[model samples]
Structures are given as C-alpha cells and as structure tokens.
Target: MVLEAAVLYVKPGLEKAYESAFQQASAIISSMKGYRSHELQRCLEVKGKYLLLVEWESLEDHTIGFRQSVEYQDWKQLLHHFYEPFPVVEHFEKVDLT
Candidate 1:
C-alpha cells in the first residue's frame, strides 16, 4: 500500500468552511479506483493546520488514476481554495521491521 500524506494549512477564519468542504469532497476521493481509506486530522496546537492521510494500492492509483480523472477537478474546486500557500503532498511505503 502507498500512503499519501499532506499538511494542509487552511486560511485563517475559514477552518469551519474548510472542514465542511472537506466533508463534501471526501466522497469524490473515496469513490476513486484503488482507494483504500483516508483520514483528516485537525491540529490541537495549530489553529489552521490539518493532516490528511490517504491510503492507495499504489502510487499510480493517486498520481494517475485519481489526479487524472474528472473527479479530481471536483475535489480541487471544493477544497483547493481553502489552502493559503498550498500543501505539499508526499507518498510513502511501509517498511517491515520484523
């Protein structure tokens, strides 16, 4: 599985709207191919910071399958405007320790 992570810095005073928009946008991503699961976490210390984590079957599932699809446009329209400077998204693969 590939883990997609992003630190979202929402515009101040728009946290509630951002969250609401995220709620609406979740469906867009969840329906995509290779989507496993996702979570949105609000920072306790930071006022407008959030952590977004999504699990995909592979990098292509996100970078290509989702990003290239029509649903991505809706996702962007719903949530992209909430970001101030935009977030940096990164992907990770699990390492077995045992």
Candidate 2:
C-alpha cells in the first residue's frame, strides 16, 4: 500500500469553509481507482492547519491514476482556493518493524 500525505495550511478565517469543501471533495477522490481510504485531521494548536492522509493500492494509483484524471480537476477546483500556499504532497511505503 502507498500512503499519500500532505499538510494543508488553509487561509486564516476560512477553516470552516475549507473543511466543508474538503468534505465535498472527498467523494471525488474516494471514487478513484486504487483508492483504499483517506483521513482529514485538524490540528489542535494550529488554527488553519490540517493533515490529509490517503491510502492507495500503489503509487501510480495516486500520482498517475488520480492526478491524471478529470476528477483531480474537480478536486483542485473545490479545495485549491482555500489553501494559503499550496501544500506539498508525499508518499510513503509501510516499513516492516516486526
């Protein structure tokens, strides 16, 4: 599985609006190919910071499958404007610790 993560810094005073938009945008990503699950976490100390974590079957599932699809355009349109300075997304692979 691939873990896609990003730290979203929403513009001040738009936290509630951003959350609403993210909720609406969630459907766009959840319907994509190889999508497993996702979570949006709000920061406790920070006013306009959030953590977004998404699980995919593979890296290509997100980097190519989703990002290259029309759904991504909708996702962008719904949530992009709420960001103060675009977030940087990264992917991770689970490590065997046992």
Q: TM-score: which candidate is best?
A: 1
Q: Against the true structure, candidate 1 has what lDDT?
A: 0.98
Error of 2 at 39 (Å): 0.4
TM-score of 2: 0.98
The digit string of per-residue lDDT tens for model 1 on 1-98 reads 99999999999999999999999999999999999999999999999999999999999999999999999999999999999889999999999999
- Once superposed on the true structure, which residue ranges of model 1 sit more than 4 Å away at CA? none
- Per-residue lDDT tens digits for candidate 2, residues 1-98, read 99999999999999999999999999999999999999999999999999999999999999999999999999999999998889999999999999
Where does model 2 exceed 4 Å of error? none
lDDT of each: 0.98, 0.96
Clash counts for the predictions, in order = 0, 0
Residue 11 CA error for candidate 1 (Å)?
A: 0.2
Give the Å shift of residue 63 in candidate 2: 0.5
Give the TM-score of each candidate.
0.99, 0.98
